[model samples]
Target: MTEKIAVLGAGSWGSMLAAILNENGHEVQLWTRSAAQADELNQKHTNRAYIQNYTFPENLRASTDLETVLTGATEILFIVPAQATRAVATEVDRILAKLGQRPALIHGSKGLETTTHLRVSQILAETISPEHRTSISVISGPSHAEGVVKHDPTLVTVASDDFDAAQRFQHLFMNDYFRVYTNADVIGVEFGGALKNIIALASGALAGLGYGDNARAALMTRGVAEISRLGVSFGANPLTFAGLSGMGDVIVTATSTNSRNYRAGYQLGQGVPLADVVANMGMVIEGIATSQSAYELAQTTGISMPITEAIHAVLEQEETVETAIHHLMTREGQAENG
Candidate 1:
């Protein structure tokens, strides 16, 4: 069956996913906020600013009209930034209400709401009317827009509290080049996706400071451990941390140059100011905000997340990158399993 899918963001990741879906023979509507971008994609079949060197499928439509994008869509995927999820969901709710239609909701974004510290799915649930929401799922893992655009082998996880919904999402995106797995651990999957960015930033900073593979390896290893600890405290399954959305995500984001968080951290390590790093990146660095939220969540939950604390300190300018590294190294040693 050819499903009509609406993608609610035209950023790199969103546009790339829309292209992939179009390739899979699905009818795709990619919504962008800018009329210029919509016109460009419609006329040129290329989102040059976001996904370079790639032409979108001719059948893939781009629009700035939210109503036109959502009209007759079987599924709606929210690919906007985490901070924008609530606002987008509210708008979606109004549209769904006016249309008297309900569609499966999926989110590709990975981060918590800064003040509420709520997961993306949670925010969606709060804003979208229950009657108008079929199911909520999140797609996250090691997949990057740059690699996915090139059709490189990519694997990701789709998680939902409803197992059937997870399987449905897994089926939707799975293909020869893109593999999807189903997981019922929504909390773990979301946290693993969001928190890994913090570690990526830290790893990038370490590399920028001339640290080698050993330091990066250590940071990644310890980073996943803390992620699992904090996630477990929040009712997430501890074993989920070992799966695609957990260790898998951490490895890719923390080590790959494709990661915005890693890039931001690298610049920070080179003594670039946070404001400058953000201004120059041209994309949202999710870890910068996530670090603060994660640190606050840890404090409230009584979980020990030293790596998150260190990254948060550096991002907040409370400590220099060098000082943060030194403090981490000088911390009292504890059992690896603890």
Candidate 2:
């Protein structure tokens, strides 16, 4: 029952999935671009740069060889940062074509490219042919790798336009500690997955300002509204926002102590420079890129997303948190539902 699985990134999230899949009796191969890191994981059984405590599972292997990873991998999980996704996907496609085999693809990263403003699934569709489309799935939600790696109970949604691929992905991920659900709304899933990080940054800003639950609650609720609105504009089902990938993800990211975006924002709110905050966090904060993409998408679609705009402003340091709040609160009045 062991399946050949390849993870394309060896960051924290990638290493976590490699461990989880290995625990599930899968042949897991974790690929990192850094040969030094790969050698360390192969010899030390640990990813010293990311997850420090646990040794990699015995069945899990690490390598810098992309061809070796793709040739034998029947299912490949793409876990690189969102900005790097396209390059990695293109490389993977070329490697797979060279091998004359197409494997199922799963992306665990969240965020759209700021320059292209394309969702991960859309980028994948463009990179791979329709014949390979059925093999793509997106697995995302509130599940943080830090929690999941420790065997905490976490739930996430795996979505594909293709139903059978969703089911197959569900089987690959579901376990006693990890619960997997299936949905066909790939657009909404991807949007919610990316947008929540931006909102979490806003939530952290509010928390750092010593704002009460009222502020956090408002940010979370209205944040979901904006996310859902923008998602529906992209042809995603409006209902997916209420599911695991949307509201569920927002809650976890906005409130959790482990969220990198939230932590970055908290420091920003406490008067730290954005560059310093990111440097101190020592992780890729997807929200920083996602905020620009959301702002651009909102402008293109003529959709109103004040919260995302506020986050964008703060990110650019165009306006302080106080000014951003004042702008939001004193904006022209409209009906609550409008």
Candidate 3:
């Protein structure tokens, strides 16, 4: 059955997901905060702001009006930046409550908001009614919008506390080019999705420093250790760290040139200032906020995440990358055990 889907945000990932849903025969309403962009999509069938090369499907409609997007929206897929999720959720909550029904939600944003230090789903629950919590799902994986727009084969995960919702999203979005898997460990999935961006930045920094495969491999492996240790402290399943949202996402984002975090780190490693790096990237590199939240989360949870700490020092505290590296290298050694 064709479902009415609302994709909020008209950025690369949002446009790509809208295209995917439209191709799947669902009625898709892709919303843009910018009225100009929304008009362009309606007129040109393309999002000039992000996915400039590809055309949106004919079945895909767009609007700048939030209410229009919410009209008959059975499921809301939020593709906004991580920092904007809370504000968007707040807006959605107010409107949805007035409507007297809540749609299932799928957040595609990755990273924890620095101020709140809450994952996307947590932010949703906090902004919306608690009764709506179980209806939230997260779709995550190694998906990069650059590839997904081209109809490239990509694997993603749909995770929720509600197994039925997970399976529903799996069926809703999965396609020959896009494969979706369902995982019931909501916290673990969200944590892995949010935290791995930090690791990607570290790996990008390593690659930016002219480090080879061995260095990136070491960073990726150790990054998982740091993320898993932190997640375990917060009641997440340790094994989830080894799954798609964890190791899988880390590998893809850290190594790929298309990843905003990796690209930002690459420039940073190449001696660009943080501000310059961010300005040049031209998209939201979630790792910036994730790095901040990871540091705060580690300190709050008493988890010793040296890598996350280093990233925090470099990005937030404006510590030199050299200084951060030296600090990491000089850490005291301990036995590797549970």
Candidate 4:
């Protein structure tokens, strides 16, 4: 069942998703605010700005005009930054409102909104009209944009409170290389995906400090515990923390050089300024922004997330990474479960 799909955002992930959907025989329109990016994608069939060295399918189209992309799109995939999600979703509401079109909504972006702490699905639900958003689902896992674009073997879960909707989207992106599974626990999946970035930042800091694998392993294991504790407080199933979005995502993001969060943390550990790290990266580092939100959320919910708190101090409160690590290490010991 080939459908018309509009993929908003022209970054690496959006470009790759457009390529995959195009290959799947869907009429895929990639939307970007950058006219240059749109022209390059439509003319040269390459999004070298983000995903380098990969030629996009010629049939995959990109445009700067929002209405051109959304006029008849049956499904919309949001791959923009989490901070940018609400703005794009609001525009989606305006356009689809006029067209009287109801499209399936799936967000591949992960991160809690800064102050609101709203998940991507929650923002979409609150912004888009009820008539238009009968279903809002999320796709998340260990898959990175660079890897997925290269056809790396990747598996992810699509989640929704509406189980049937989740199953429907499962077939949309599933291929031999990119397999999809259905999950009903949207809260656990979103929290897992969002919170793992903070841990990855800490892991990268360990790597930067020349700490061995032992340090990274300990951080990640304890990171999962912190994640599960908070996720459960938010009504998420604790076992979900053991699944793909949690442990699987945490492993890849924390250990891999491809992760922007890890790279940012690595630079922080090397005494680089936060602004410099972010500017040099030339991409959104979700962890830096997410750390503050995660820390604040933990405070409001009275959840103990020492790792998250430490990283938030480093990223937002001007505490040095080394100092944060020192504090974490010197904290009073407790039972393993505690």
For this target, which candidate reaches the highest lDDT against the unseen true structure? 1
What does each candidate score in C-alpha RMSD? 0.9, 1.4, 1.6, 1.0
Clashes of 2: 0
Candidate 1 residues lying further than 4 Å off, grouped into runs, are none
The digit string of per-residue lDDT tens for model 3 on 210-246 reads: 8899878988888999888988887889888888888
lDDT of each: 0.91, 0.88, 0.85, 0.90
Scored by TM-score, the top model is 1
Per-residue alpha-carbon lDDT of candidate 1 for residues 137-198, written as tens digits (9 for 90 to 100): 99999988899878899999899988888887777788999999888899999999999999
Query: For residues 17-124, could you state the per-residue lDDT of candidate 2 as single tens digits?
Result: 888888888888888999998888888888878775778876578888888887777888999999998888888888877777767888988999878999997788
CA lDDT, candidate 3, residue 250: 90
CA error at residue 20 for candidate 1, angstroms: 1.3
**Model 3 weakest lDDT span, ten residues long:** 125-134
Candidate 4: tens digits of C-alpha lDDT, residues 119-177? 88999999999898668999999988889877889988999998888988888888889
TM-score of 4: 0.98
- Candidates in descending lDDT order: 1, 4, 2, 3
Stretches of candidate 4 above 4 Å error? none
* Candidate 3 error regions (>4 Å): 130-134
Candidate 2 CA-lDDT value: 0.88
TM-score ranking from best candidate downward:
1, 4, 2, 3
